[model samples]
Each structure stands twice: as C-alpha cells, then as structure tokens.
Target: MTQQKIRWLVVLMSLALIGLVIFQVVGVRETLNAKEDQFDGSVTEALDAVAHKLEKTEVAVLTSRRLAAERRKEKLQQIAIHDRPAKTEPKGRKASPRKADPATIQRYASHSPIVQQWEFYGRVTVPSDVLNRTNGTLTDAEMHYVEEYYRNESPPLNPDNRLRSELEKTYDETMFRNLRKDVESVKARRDSVGKFLANRVVGDRKAAPVRKHMPKEAAAKPKVTFSRPRVSRIDSARLPHRHMTEFEKAEQKSRVMREVLLDMFTNDRPLNQRVDMAILDSLLKNEMSIRGISIPFEYGLRSDDNPHDFIFTSSPGYREDRLLDGYSMQLFPSDLMATDNMLYVYFPERQSYLAQQVWTTLVSSVILILVMASCFYVAMSTIVRQKKLSDMKNDFINNMTHEFKTPVSTISLATQMLSDEAVAASPSMLNRYLGIIRDENQRLGSQVEKVLQAARFDRGEVRMMRDQVDLHELIETVVHSLSPQVEARNGVMHTNLGAKQSIVTGDEVHLTNLIFNLLDNAIKYSGEVTDVSVSTASSADGVRVTISDKGIGMTKENLRHIFEQFYRVPTGNVHDVKGFGLGLSYVKKIVEEHKGTIRVDSAPGKGSTFEVWLPF
Candidate 1:
C-alpha cells in the first residue's frame, strides 16, 4: 500500500484499539459493579441470617433468666415456709367456732370480693372441704350481708363481718401476717434476681448495680432482714447442703448464686461471643466463597445509640468507620435488652476481590492487542523492505543489460568491419578487428562468470578447492590485474603487505576473486582520481586485510547494507558506473566459506574501510 494509505490505516487501527480498550474497560467496570452488587446482596443476606441467630440466642438467654428468677422465688418461698412458727390452738378461744352456713361459705368462695382478693394474694390457704360443704342454710340477713360484700358496698351490722371476726379468732393472725411478709420477701428476692441477671448476663461492668429494697419492719428486725453474704469461689457440687447450719446454708446459697452468676456473665459471655464470631465468619466465608470473593474481614458489636463505641470486637484495631470505607454490614439484636446494640462486619481486601474478578479478561485483552500490534509492525516492515529490494533489483537488471550490451555491440561492430571487402584486403586491418572481438568476448565471459558465481553461492553449491597459497603474492597479483583500471580512472592504489604470517590454505581462484571485487568496488564508488589503499597484518589467529578508499564515501546507513545481495548506494541519475550489485555480496560469501569475517567502518562524507580476517 501507499504510505498515505498505510498511515491512515495505522491511525484508524490506533483509534479502533483505543476505542475497544475504552469499551472493554467500561464493560469490565459495569461487570464488576454488578458483581459487587451481587456480593453486597449476599453479604446482607448472610448478616441477616446471623442477626436472626443472635436474636434467637438472646431469646434463649432471657428465657433462662426468667426460669432462674422463678426458681429463686420458689426457693425463697420454701425458706419462708420452713421459718414460719408452728400453728397452736388459742387457749382463751376454746369456745365452739361459729360455723359458716353452707350457703354463706359458697357465696364467699364463689363471689365475695374479700375472698377473691385473698385468693389472688396466693398467701391464704383455705380448706377445700370448707368450700365444698353444703349442709347448712343461710338467714335472710346473712344473704343480705353476702350480697353487700359481693357488691363491694357497706352494710349495716353485716353478718359477713361477724363471720370474718369469728374466722379470725380461729385463724392465727400473726401467722397470716407472717405469710404476707414471706410473700413480700419472695417478691423482693425475685426483683433482686431479675436485676442481677439484667446487669450480668450481657457482662457489662459499667452497668448499674442491683439495688436492695426492704420493708421498714424487716429493716428494723436485724435477724429477719435478708443480707447478701460475701461469697468466695467454691465447687457447688461438693457442698453438703442437707446437714448445713442456717448460716452455712445461707453462705452456700450465696456462693452458688455467685458461681452461677459468674459463669453466666464471665465464662459464658466469652464462649458465646466466640460462637457468634464463628458463626459470622462461617457465613461470610461461605457466601463470599460461592461468589469467589476472598478478603480479610473483621467484625464487632457497637451500641446503636453510640455507633462509635464498640462493646466487643473479634479482633484488635477494629474501627467503627472501617465498615463505611469498605464492604460492610450492620445487624441489630432482636432482644429488648440489647436492641440498642448493632453488629458490624468489614472487609479489608476489596481491591484484591475486584482484581481477581477481572484478571482473566484483562490478560486476554492485553494479549490480543499485543499480538495484533506485533503482526501489524512486522507486516509494515516487510512491505517497506521488499519495496526497497524491488527498486535495487530493477537498477541491477538495467546495469547488467547495459554492461552486456556494450561488449556485444563492440564485438558485432568489429566483426562487421572485418567482413568488409576493403578491410579484408589488408592483414593488419583483419588482425586489429580480430583483436577487438577477442577483448570484447573476454569482457562478456567475465561478466557471465561473475553472475554464475553469485548463482552458485545462492544454491549453496560454491565449494572451495582448498590449497596452500601465499597471501602477499595473491595481493600482488590482484593489484597488478587492477592497476590498469586504476590508471584509466586516474586513481592512486597503495598496498602494505607487512604480515609476518602470509601463508594460508584456501581456494586461489575464489581468494583472487574476493580481492578483485573489493578493489573494483573501491574504484567504482570513488570520485574522480580515486585514492585506494590495501594493507595486511597478522591477527591473533588469522591474517587481516584492510581496503580503504578516499571516494564518495557512504553514510552509516548505506554501510550497514553495503554487503547485502543486490544492494547498492544511490548514485543519482547519472549512469557513470555500472554493476550487477553483487560484488560485495560475493566477496562476503567467499570470505565466510573460508571461515573468515568482514567489518566496515564509515560515516557520512567520510571514507569507508573494509577489513577482512581469514584464519591461517
């Protein structure tokens, strides 16, 4: 293609490549975004599952606390029952107890507000037989009293009041009062236990301490007043509770409570925390692995009310805002006590995740682009080199045709003159014409031989006839042979055969041709009055020959390709010198066949030097 077309093609290709890269980058970005969105969705779902699990765990813990509180209240009740004084018959009230009418007892049990209130307290124990008796009748006045009490209205001289007074005489008033006190004491213990659990279950040392509340009467009685005893660590399993004194029982109870509270608050907190973290890690890894995301992560719990304050963390160096900077999630506990707390998870290796996601696509795109670029460069270079070679070959053909035509034309003209009757009459004229033909024929044969020599080298058929030869003698003979050409061109030739080791093994014919080609090139490329020099010296393992010319010296660029086949320096439009452009190529080939090397040194506007080294 023409340079303009090639340049346009290159520009177009560059634009296409840039556009493709941009499009691919955009596509990759979108794909990554979509993948990130998918990953975020998965993380959200996994965190939600973890949050749900935590909520369930919280529910279980709370249920356990409620059960523990109930058991404590039951124990306190049993203790109160054990401490109550035994019931004794009243000495002054030996009078027969006024029996309640069957209808009255039924009325009180079924509908009386006072009896309902007593039953609600769970303190008063009434006999089932008394409520079930149906042997007596009620008076109209007693019926009126029962109706008034059930209506919660005041009555005039109510029979229900008189019956209550008689029943109070039969029942020990102090014992009832003590039962009420025991009920209050159980409630207080339940409240204390509730407070203890609330403060300790979550294992927060900064929490408010459990307060003690006692009634005024109980506070006044030192013996009856419940005091929390100091407890030291002990194995509850080894304690003999059955034979213990009251004080020892109290101490054992206190110790058991302390141990249970410590286990729940201290040991259980860390264990549960670890379990929660394990669950979170497993969920996160499973979700991320499914999506092919591998990244380092951290998790922590923080109060929702105070997001900056971390309650707990899976590891050190946990920052509250790390979640905001990278991939993260937040979860809230379902339990009311911990509803303000939030769990946060953070992923640190986000870049690695993105890179891994697109690594294959990126490599494939780069490789494809590089391969295309390399192919384009090679093709362009080959086209340019081939165009240069085609031009050189055309010049070579034209020069060769001219060289052959000149000799043939001269030979034809000489023969024509010799065939003339007038010229044939003189022996001198016939001999002169014959000599011209002979010389022209020899020139033609030499040109043909040079062409054949190049052809033999191309086919790898140029075998050397190895023999011992004197390098100095060879140089002298070749110089003598080219002396006439140098004289014709008015050029000076100098030789310095100063090598101590001049004998070498080589084909004399090819060696002579090698020297002749170099000398001929020097004369051909040189300006008018060409100046040339040939010198020789002994090398480490070879003989060195150097030929220099003070001609129209070549540039560095031309010197590089001077020995290439069919390559010639541009000499303008003037056809002053002629050649097939194979002289230097043949010279280099012959030198290499004999295991030799050639080197050239030249610069623009400066003379060139060709040095040939051949092993002795």
Candidate 2:
C-alpha cells in the first residue's frame, strides 16, 4: 500500500483499538462499582441482622429475669401451703357458701374507694373519660413506691394504703381487660355484618304507649340494655412519641412499650451483658456467608455518643480510626438502656475480595489487549517493509534495463560500423569496432549472469560445485583483475595474507564471485583515491577474510538493510556507480551455502568494513 493509504488504515485501526480499550475499561470500572455497591449492601444487611439478634437476646434475658422472680415467689408460697393443715369435712354434708367476714369487709371499705363505691351504689361505675385524664408516666411518689415495693427492705409506710392502691390498680386493669375483650367481639360482629346495626350516636326515645306496654307483674325486675358507646379520646401524652396512622404499618406504641419494659427489667443489669460479642460474631458470619462474603473481619460495639468508647469488640483492630472504614449499625435500636451502643464491622481484604470477583475477566482482557497490540505492530511493520521492498525492486529493474540497453546499443552500433566498407578497409578501425563489439558483448553477458545468479539463489535453485578453494589465492585472483581500475583511480589495494591455512570446502565458482563482488564494491564506492584492504587469517574457524575500504561510508540505517535484496545506500549526484542492488544479498547467500557468515560495520563520514568467516 502507498504511505497515505497505510497511514489512513493505521489511524482507523488505532481509533478502533483505542475505542475498544476505552470501552473495556469503562465496562470493568462499572462492574467493579456494581460489585462494590452489592458488597456494601450485603455487609450493611448482615450488620443490621446481627444487631437485631443482639436485641432479641437482650429482650429474652429481661423476660427470663421476671419469670425467675415470679417462679421463686410461687415456690415459696407452695411450701407454705404444704406446711399448713387441712380442714376436716362433715360427713354426708355439702359445704354451705361462705359469707364475707364483717370485720374484713369493714377494713377493706375503710381503705379502698372501689369498696366504698360498691357499698354506696351497689355497682361500681368508672367515668367513661377517666383514661384520658391520666398520663402513663409515674409521679415521683409512685416511682418511690415502686422502688420500695420491689426492694422489700421493711414494712411499707402504710400497708393498708398500699393494699387499697393495689386493689384499685387491679380493678382498673380488669375493667380495661374486659373492655378490650368486648371490643374484639364487636369487631368480629362488625366484620361479619359489614356495619354496626346501632348507630354510633344515641337515638331519641319515644314515650311508651299504654296499649303496647305490659303491666308490671309481681316479682318482675326490668333490665336496661345499652347501645355500644362511642370510642373516647386517649391521652396524647400517654401515646407513643410517633403517632400511629393509617400509613404506618408497625405499632409504634407497642414497640415503645416493649423497649420501656426491657429497660425497666434490665436497667440495673451490666451494660456489657446486654450484648454478647461472640454470638454477634456468629450471626454476622452466617449472614455474610449467605451473601458470599467469606473473608476475615473484625467487629466492635462502640458507644453512639462517643465512638471511641467501646462496649465490646470481637477484635482490637476494629477501633476508632477504622470506624469509618466499616459498616455501622445500631444495636438494640429501640432499647432505651442499650441505645448508646452501635455495631461496627471492618474487613481488611474487602477490596481484594471485590477485585477477585471479576479477576478472570480482567486478566483475560488485559492479556488479549496486549496480544492484539503486539500482533498489530508486527503486521504493520511487515506491510511497510513489503512496500519498501516493492519500491526497491522497481529501482533495480530500471537500473538493469539502462545497464543492458547501453551495452546492447553500443554492440549494435559497433557491428553497424563494421558493416561500413570504408571502415572495414581501414584495418585499425575495423579491429577497433570488432574489439568494441566483443567488449560490449562481454559486458552484456556479465550483467545477465549477475541477474540470473541472484534470481537462482533466491529460488534455492543454484547448486554448489563443492570443491576445496584457497581463500588466499582467491583474494589474489580478484585483486589482480581489479588492479587496473584501482590504478585508474590512483588507489591502492593492500593485502594481509597472514593465515597459515586458508583452504575451505566450497563451490569454486560461487566463492570466486563472492570475493569478486566484495572487492569490486570497495573499489567503486571508495573516495576518488580508493584505499582498499584484503586480508585472510588463520583462526579457530579455519579461514577469515576481511575486505575493508576507506570510502564514502554509509550510515547506521543503510548498514542495517545493506544485505537485503534490492537495497542500496543513497549516493547523491554520483551516477558513475551502478548495480542491480543485489550484490551483497547474493554474497551473503553464497557464504551461507558454504556454512559461513558475513557482517559489516560503518558509520556516517567513517570508513566501512566487511568481514567473512568460513569453516574448513
């Protein structure tokens, strides 16, 4: 391809590769981000789960304490009952119903308002809006009473007063319990009927007519039936901090009451006992494994108010500095006593773990990208080199055409001159034209042979005439033949035949051509006054031939491709030098056929040296 087309191709291919690389990079980046987000979500969920479990265990512990206390009291009561004596029964007589003792009734009536209300009206009726008037919080006096009741250090300040208050508390609790039961039954009825039969508001009553009403009989007692009452408003202060609404699913009031109960039972308990770090660790591990997170981790329970203050830790590494590095979750989130404790978990290898999720894809993509880059580079280089070779081949063909045309034209012109009768009569002129034709014919044959030899060697069709050749004698023969050209340029050819043995088994004809080509290149390319040297030395390899010239030497770039077919160094404005640019390539091939090697050394403005080594 031409340079322009090659350039466009390279640019287009480069853009494609760059775009693919960018696309891959972006995809990997997004994948990593997704993995990270998923990891964070899984970790947060696990942490919340562990915190929730800790809260459950704390609640269970508080409930167990209350049960143990009640059990102990019941066991003592059972022992007392067992020790007491049983009353004897009268034979064949059913026990009569026991009447209340008048003194016991008098004592209770003196202390309890419930007893007084029953005595006066013969029915205890609590106000409908009584619940709205009382806030759920206990007063200072009530709190002291509760504390004293639980401690039981001594007799209460007023035992009867306490007993009367307890009775009133029990009566209010029973009334509310019965009311809740009645409301539940009414809800079921409403669901079945889809609506209440009686309206929420009480209706006006009509006077009973004498015709429809029945006369009162002896010992007849009438009972009045009341409609369902309207729901009274509750005290806002007694309600949970967050109001319950239609949109709210969880019962905030119930959850708050549970927290309150838990705090009341466990407020005096040890703070560390509220959560077990060991159990918390187990819960975290199980949750994380469910999400495919199998890695070492550290966890800590730190105070929410002051994170530096740790309540407990699975490991010391989970500290204040690393608190931000981990997932944080509130422990016993609704527990009033354990509200300050927060859970924190950190993993040292979290980044590595996330990277490993796409490790196979990442590694494979990078390797493929490198291989593609390498292959692209090699292909581009091969294409460009082939283009250069095509250019060089064209140059060689043009040079050979000119070289052959000059010789053939001269030969044709000389023969034409010999055909002149007058020139033939002049012996000297006739002899000159004949010699000219003969020399031109020899030139044409030599050029044709050089081309044929190079082509045959390239096709591996040139068979070597294997024979022992003496390099010392071969060098001398080539030098003698080119001595006249060296003289014409006022140049000298030096020889150093220092080798004791210079015999090598090789094709005599090809070896002679190899030596002749090297010597001829030295003479032609050397400066006006050619300075050439030919030397052969005895070495471990049998023979070493060196041909060097103090000539217009080549640059490093030219020396690199000097042995490539159809490659020639640029010699500007010096048209006298001419060749098919295949001399060195043929020479190198000939040396290789004989199991030898050739090398050159040259730099700009410096002389050039060509070295040839052959084995015996």
Q: Which candidate number maximizes TM-score? A: 2
Q: Please report, in order, the local distance difference test score of every candidate based on alpha carbons.
A: 0.68, 0.71
| Native-to-model Cα distance after best TM-score fit, residue 372 in candidate 2, in Å | 4.4
RMSD of 2: 14.7
Q: Taking the tens digit of each residue's C-alpha lDDT, what string does model 1 give over 1-616?
A: 5667767877787777778778777877887787778778877776776667655555465556655885566555555543443433333322221234555546455654434433223323211121222333446687787677856765555674564444433343433333444333332122212221111111112222322333565445433333442223333444323342332343344434444433333332322353366666676577666655566777776655556667667677666678545444445332223434556677777667767777887778778778877877787678777777887788878989999999999999998998899999999999999999999999999999988988888899888899998989999999998999999988899999999999888999999999988988888878876899999999779899999997788887887788888887888889887888899999999898999999988765567789999999
lDDT of 2 by residue, 448-501 (tens): 998898889878899988988888888888899999999999999999999999
Candidate 1: clashing pairs of residues: none
| Lowest summed lDDT window (length 10), candidate 2 | 201-210
**Per-prediction count of colliding residue pairs?**
0, 1
> Which candidate number has the best lDDT?
2
Clashing pairs in 2: 499-538
